[model samples]
Target: MEGVVSVNPNHVCKLHTTRSWDFLNLTLKDVGSPQESDVIIGLLDTGIWPEHPSFNDTGLGPPPSKWKGACTGQNFTCNNKIIGARYYNSDNSSDISDIQSPRDSIGHGTHTASTSGGVEVAGASYFGLAEGIARGGVPKSRIAVYKVCWAFGCSYADILKAFDDAIADGVDIISVSLGSPWPSDYFDDPIAIGSFHAMKNGILTSNSAGNSGPNPVTVSNFAPWSLTVAASSIDRKFVARMELGDGQILAGTVINAFDLNGTSYPLIWGGDGANYTIGSSPDIARYCLNGAMSTDKVAGKIVFCEAGLDGSGVLAANGVGTIMSDALIVNPDYSFSWPLPATLISPEDGKTVLDYIRSTESPTATIFFSNAWKDVMAPKVVSFSSRGPSAISPDILKPDITAPGVDILAGWSPLAPSTVYQDDTRSTLYNIISGTSMSCPHASGAAAFVKAAHPNWSPAAIKSALMTTAHVLDPSKHEDLEFSYGSGQINPLAARDPGLVFDASETDYINFLCKQGYNTSTLRLVTGDNSTCNNIKPGRGWDLNYPSFSLYVKDGEKISAIFTRTVTNVGAANSSYTVTFDMPPLISVTVEPPVLVFSYVGESNTFTVNVTGPVISQWPITSGSIKWMDGTHVVRTPLVVYNYLPGAPYNLDSEQAYTMTRESLGLTHSNVYHKTGMGQSRAHPQFL
Candidate 1:
């Protein structure tokens, strides 16, 4: 515990495990451990500290042996017997021989590696992902670490180099935790396009869903070939900090506020005549008031003010507390504390507690610094996670999954220049970090598990395992949290046990390209500049018919199904599952099912959906529906509905379901039948 920061001891139990409750109590031994020779997972983040105790005895130590030159010939030997690492910082001017190839200036790589595939050295957890003390999800797997994130915001250029290098090295699995918030065309995005190539080459890749929370997924790192991970608070518990009287105390067990979608900001007030009644509405009083600004309003009192307000630096400028922004922070929590407060809550609580202070007596009412912080529990998705729809294939599903992100605790480098806030403080060890920068490794770790279990599976198969087997429930609520937490939380154990899979291949993507109307030869020339399109060939043009496409049409209107997935049962190839598509009249939908038949264990299928009405132009007055049928049972596809309305262009209204039965699909069933869509939309644009 030399450099270990101790989060409040009360919350220690929560930190004992990284996975959500649903994924608890599972291990590598429980899941099948296939041959690992074919699985070389890659980590693209801050460089790793191979010298860390975790890989000491495993021979996966620091650079030179672990680190190799960026050149394909020098870096990837295709040996499969060792961990491969490379560094690519544009600012540095050194060759593989001039400087160390695997030296990590930042510790992020080390921590991420420990989480994904560490080799259980001493001082590591006995049962967790990573080799040292902890056992990573894929304990038997090897790794290929690449340093892409630099001291400055990781340049898009460095990331591209890393991607090309990873591919040239022929890594079987690639994981990238770095991303951006701004939107970009999927194909236009170099990283995304590169991931596509990696997948085509039979390399499974995973990226972070980003850490920008409470924001729509309009900004995400999307690649049809990658699994995009989103962060969720495990069990909704985290550490917190409480400042009382003049003494500050490290606190524990704060309230779980990760689900505060509509929660308001806190307001603060201070000094003489500061007496104020606690309002009945806790929602409206989320600000902190303090300093000289409180003189006119509550002279001598402290008024904690909101951070972001219109034309005002403090509450005095606005005069009205409620008119200001959300909760006020007494001071920014720049450096992360041990189990840092799960999130930063309203500063009003601190001001409220301080208001009750008496020179000669202990403050009677201790403002409950309850664990209500959310940022602490879940780090923000970085602004740089590549986003969708694919510029080249806008219709295809990209970024198949989401994982943990936010200020993740990872290895640090005292030698490296400051990257995050804590790094500037000269802290060589623990650092607080956020962004998709922390999410990508999660999927990579998962891919390692998949590769270990299904050595013969293709990149699409691995992605299918993660997505098809993903648990879409919020770890905090133990229920579904869609859009925000795609495919739910990362359940590596479940991903390993995917009963059936919907596998795709390079041919499938080529077919997808052909459907988009791109000539195969022309596409080959454009993507690879060759007559022969390798498995890693980039698609020639955009695909407007991916299953994950969004449809905005007038209410009660019908849409066409231009795309659908073909699923096969590796465990039970002969087992047949009914395939039916249903929709509400408000939003009529159809699919080409004959193309979706699963004739054999590894068979594939395809189809699409086409919206018939204008997008965001004509508003419908009603809602629409979408559903699916599987033989004797009928189930509804989650989160697919919309409707247009008068005066409004397009409104994502509530979902209305229409009945579809096994008999309708030429099958028989005796069970009671009823199905409803969970994500109900309304006729309000703001509701979206």
Candidate 2:
């Protein structure tokens, strides 16, 4: 990736890119055949490296096959050489659809695009997205590069324009590797609205879940329409950095997991500055090593600030002595350092080092503090990513999955414009980068591959394939929380072959809308609002709804929404699978198309369910219980109850069916219903 930028020395770029959990599960053979699947993928980033050797390969070809400008009012041909790139900076004279968008101003875009769809690098191939040498998840997929993000940061309008261009160009997948700190208001932010539109049109939109680590809230891609991806560090046995100590800043030994001051080192409590804060002034805040620097009150030695305080840049700038922090920096250990000294310690070794520095009284009275990345062994989530209870609808799930984020090696511009330079090395070549930005392209490429294999699969089906096929359990994490890893890791192989899926249709969305108290008039109003903003609540039918699988099925008297999912191998197109669902005591779920059957491969099915009760589950539904199941495998949806019954019955003439949903399940409430049959004796049912 290459791009121009507005220089801001204090601004910290988002670290950590998103990649798949099954990055190692794919091989070159899976996508090696040239043009086998002519799916077009849109990359919305700084840009791509049109001249990279990887672009010369059969699968990862040059522009015409790589780029497309098929949208109305747009003339960008899918010509390999057309280069329909655009510069968003006001300083640049370029406008939308300039056909020169292929040029990467910043190396980040190029790297991400390369990782997702790059040609194989001899032995290095196995190191990227999948173990397959010379193959991305979707090697044969064409690209529609949307150069939306310029160094000043992508504007909502720029992002919106990119989406419209990409969608009009008919790209199968849209990958956005950039993020903004601003909150996503429903009325503004055309990018979010545009993403929702893309998904409505069956385009798979993938975005970075932001690099905000360890926080359960950060929502990078808040729009429900896009696949918001979080990042995880690639499990390289060793990650190395240079310790800058004037003459002492030598290349350090590389270790996968290291020990700090014994005590099994970090035990995971390291990385970023989750625990400590580094003062901006030139102060000796803390020290990591005992003898590294002696504190002379007169001759101020160095301070070893904790990792999460300021940032790597700030910590290094103080020029205090050598301080040690977790290795959260995304770039490779280039020969760059702050005026102060610094070194990176592994998370596994953080505790003991902090303990030693604190316990031992060295003549160098440097400050030593033990800052952790939330918990022991837990990786720090990057800061730029958005937090959840998403601004749009906190109840709905936004970031559907998480993937490898740290130190990802992708494509880069061989000759970058100077504005993006932290130094010449950063400016002129392919380097490893991290963040949700990196992870999204990986998914977008994978989506292209999925589209080729199952051309007819809806975005929901594709999403299901990606999520259900993902490896939720990574050996790398300490406790292996699902909140962190999400549907495990994305497994393209399993996704490619996911037998059957729960199909969500337009009606399913209508039901969901109704459950949300949106009637036809209100729905129309919302849709009209979206016309101007392009961001609105999903309305009835297929074209208006955002992502998330929704299936409509028949219930007793009315239609209910039943979300059905398929597992691997258990329910194929030709097989009959017995389906059964038991509702929680208080809530009732009616399954539509309850008896799911598939006639041929790639055919999808659905079930309808009516939820009647409080929005909260009467009893917490364990992971797989409320979800659709095919034999032993289970697919899960972060449960969101859209409907709840009114608490008390009104008088016979009273139209008192309206009620507010209880905030929590633990709250006490009364339930009252009017007696049926007016002629019969009056009777009351006690409400819980």
In candidate 1, what are the lDDT values of residues 1-688, reduced to their tens digit?
5432111111000000133211333454553354543456777765665555444434332322323334222322322323566666565544221224555555556666655665443443211111123444555566677766543435565666677787777677787665643333443355665676787677876766543333223334655556666553332233444334545443433221122222222223322223245331212222332222323443222223232221122333233222111232233222122111122334554334434343415321112223323444232222223232222333343345556553344444445322212212333333334344455666677778767777778776666666655554433432222344444455676666564565666666655555544454544522443333344434322232222333333445554333344454554445444444433344545555522344566664444444343333343222222333334222222223233222221111111111121124321112110000001111100001
- TM for candidate 1 is 0.62
What do the candidate models score in CA lDDT, each in turn?
0.42, 0.44
Each candidate: RMSD: 14.6, 14.3
Winner by lDDT: 2
Worst 10 residues of 1 by lDDT: 8-17
lDDT of 2 at 589: 59
Tens digits of per-residue lDDT for model 2 on 509-563? Answer: 4354444445454433323232221234543322223323322221222223334
After superposition, which runs of candidate 2 have C-alpha atoms over 4 Å from their true positions? 1-22, 34-37, 57-84, 90-102, 123-135, 182-187, 240-323, 326-342, 346-387, 414-421, 424-428, 474-486, 505-573, 579-595, 600-622, 625-688
What's the true lDDT of residue 70 in model 2?
A: 39
Candidate 1: deviation at residue 108, Å? 2.3
